[model samples]
Target chain A: MDEVYLFVTKKILFNLVSRPVAWFDRHIVDGFMNLIARVIERSAYMIKGFQSGRIQQYGYVFVSGTIVLVIIFIYIW
Target chain B: MNILSLFVLIPVLTCIGIVFTKNMKQTRLVSAIGMSIQLILAGLLVYLYLAERQAGNMAEMLFTYDALWFPTLNIHYTVGVDGISVAMIALTGIVVFAGIFASWKMEFLSREFFISLILLATGVFGFFISLDLFTMFLFYEIAVIPMYLLIGIWGSGPKEYSAMKLTLMLMGGSALLMVGLLGIYFYSAPDGGQLTWNLLEISKINIPIEMQRFLFPFTFIGFGILGALFPFHTWSPDGHASAPTAVSMLHAGVLMKLGGYGAFRVAIFLMPEAAQEQAWIFLILTSISVVYGAFGAIWQKDLKYINAYSSVSHCGLVLFAVLMMNQTAFNGAIIQMISHGLMTALFFALIGMIYGRTHTRMINEMGGLMKVMPFLGVVYVIAGLASLGLPGLSGFVAEMTIFFGAYQHTDTFHRILTIMATTSIVVTAVYILRVVGILLLGPIKNDHFLHLDDAKWYERLSTITLVVAIAAIGIAPLWLSDMINVSLAPIVNKISMAGFEFTSLF
Candidate 1:
């Protein structure tokens, strides 16, 4: 009885419930932060594409923004 | 002259006083005295405002003074203070006073620096008090124009590039704002009575729905960019990373606030139907700002850039709460503004002092600073805790109120967005703690770090003033909330009424 009980508790319960749970907990928590950080880093790359330090690029952006506003007001609205 | 006019006058006079000073000593001394006087006057104004409120003066604006400036265009120099404006003025006074001391050791063209700084303050004070859209815009430009010289002349790390970029982006925002303001002015009287730029007068008239729809975004986004709305927020991190200490303090602390205040006062208050119709779009944008800025701070190595990104996040929260458009949320928004102004000023002042001592801003390059410079290290920790929304801190109080108010909406969109924004608290804690652990704790990584001295008298004075204000709000938020709550009544009523009408249309 003791051998059977020990086998079930240690092997089945620990492996099925405790081990995977621990693995899941560690990976999920760590992975969530890393995933978000990765997403942000990727978005930042897109941001840097336009944040180019050139004056002409910034001007283009400004003019394009105004044009978009004009389109929104005149055409869409 | 109305006492409200003195807010602008004192700073102008300070600029004049700073001009005659020949050396750094005299220049800093004069600037300090003038700002100290301004701080005292601000305190007096708050007391008087409270006294008037106690005596049951439920007027919309107190201490108003009006004079015609352009008769044909119907422009006026109008000034007044509601509770919100008074709180903002007080914030400007405190930050400016602390900022003078933060830059006490500036020796390179010290007189010119002090002059430009005071001139910027004059613009901020003027902007807060102005009741007319024309003068308000004038003051807004006045506040913005000084950054070009302040940063380019005294800044570091591609100063010219940063200055030009900041100026051009803000100028773009201003151009948008100019169009929006003119639209409002022209539409001030649809029945074709005499046109006016006075805010109170304009609030009484209902602008046509189509015109409101057209102009609302222009105004909101114009101010939104300065408030560090995402995408356009690219200017802020670079500008802050390069500017001098006091300039960063004032710019981040008070100047960015102008965007939030103007959006609340003019854009939303005046165009309620449009704001109600369009709240979701800006709400999404502001949510992006809050979260994106927090994540952006995590990847930064430079100290100022981190704080600057964090400022974008906090200021974004201010706009987010404003869009909630309820009394509780509006109260939270104003408190958040004041709280952020104090907290960020404290962070920058401490960062400036640390950088001054170590001569480097990269967190990875330093360690175990608490052993050598215990004062700054401890203050930095407190600031970090505040940023992370620890209980009994200003950040916690402001954020709680904002989220609580937002939860009142009971709609799926608001609920989801609120949850999205709430995740930023976790991200904020991550970056703040990561920086604190790497920068202030652990073994000293450099042998020379042992020689570092703690905060000087002026540095201590600057940081302490801001910390006290932060703690005061954190501990007893009721009075401040009450003041803001009462003032938010008119704006909230307008929005709710507009909401009712919109539902009826549906």
Candidate 2:
């Protein structure tokens, strides 16, 4: 009777819950985070050469210039 | 001057005043006073709008000031507020006020700091009240510009890189928005009227369904980027994590909401057919973000990063509710915006205070803070509880309404998505509890943090204001809900445009 109970308990613990939890931890959750991290890494890569990014440095100039053009267009249309 | 105009002008003038201040004290005092006055004005506007709403003119703009600014293009200097704009304007007022108090202790280049802060605020006020497209976009550009300097000059940990990353991503969004606005302008023409940039006039000119579908993504993605829509949301965590406390407060609190506002007011309203058709795409993406952000926060050690990711989740819910295309859900979306704004602001404000004292934000490094700084701990608990959608807190009502309303209006697929989004609350609860348990309630793990001081006077003022605002809105949601319901009626009723999306492109 004791041997039978021990075997049943082991099967329930391993199959019913523990394995799925382990699989989830290793695959689903980790996989999801890794995918997000890769996307973030790729995005971060786009700005790696920003030490000399002139357009970004003086974005205000372009923005203001656009504003002036829009105003001019509005006035002269 | 019209009341709507003053909300913009006063902040601009105050920003100018701060630029010339000699010391931190004078600078803070001036900005605080200015924001207080702006708050009073916002309160007055809400009162007037509510009074007008009660008088049975709920669907129309309460007060409209229109002048033909550019006769050539028919671009007018127009401003007004329906119930929705009034609520948003009032929210901006409260957040900006609390943000000023949160930054009271900053002494480095204090003058320039306040100047930039108020300038950003001026643009936010202008954007909400704008009844003309040119005015709205101008304010939008102005609002986004100051963020670069504010973050780069005064932020911490990867500030420069974060600043650059944030600016570029937002500008990319702006470019898309510009194209969409211009497309609308060129396409719009009332039955016999000449092309105009006046929102009221353009609403009468319905574009072809095909054109609306084509233009939908431009406006949706453009504004959705700022709203921290999934996949495009990477900048937000970096931005919030690197920003100074007050800037973070305003940025996450109110600035991000501009995305939802712009998307609904412009994209969905202009292209109702597209909204109803492609809502499934939005439902899937937004629900994924809602769950994804909560899970992301679970493993994060940084307090600000946790909040940042949480924001992506909550803000996703805002857009999710918008795509529901129903009255209650739409109302709930606006309520979520306001509630999340206040709650997130409070969270950041408290985080800043803790980081100041503990010199660390890692939950593992902070153990049993409740015994040391009871006030801060208590408030943090309040904000955290609110975040997890506890009843009698602001988030609870907002989210509950969204779930109920969305389930009511949508079919099987959307219903499944709604249920998926609902599970996010469980995730949120787990993470919030983990942080609260580790940081606020546990055995003291370090001696150095034993006697850390509680919140300062200014900090207390900020937290108290936010706490009261949260509780009041949660307990008695009727007043705010009434305003949102009225403004949402036309949109929910499928009245495309209805003169709400005010920006011109041609």
Best by TM-score: 1
TM-score of 1: 0.86
Q: In candidate 1, how many clashes are counted?
A: 0
Instruction: Report fnat for all candidates as fractions from 0 to 1.
Output: 0.00, 0.00
lDDT by residue (B179-256, candidate 1, tens digit) is 999999999999989998999999988989999999999999999989998657777887998999999999999999
lDDT per prediction?
Answer: 0.89, 0.84
Top lDDT model: 1
> How does chain B of model 2 score on TM-score?
0.96
Docking class of 2: incorrect
lDDT of 2 by residue, B113-135 (tens): 99999999988888898878777
Please give the interface root mean square deviation for model 2, in Å.
Answer: 8.2
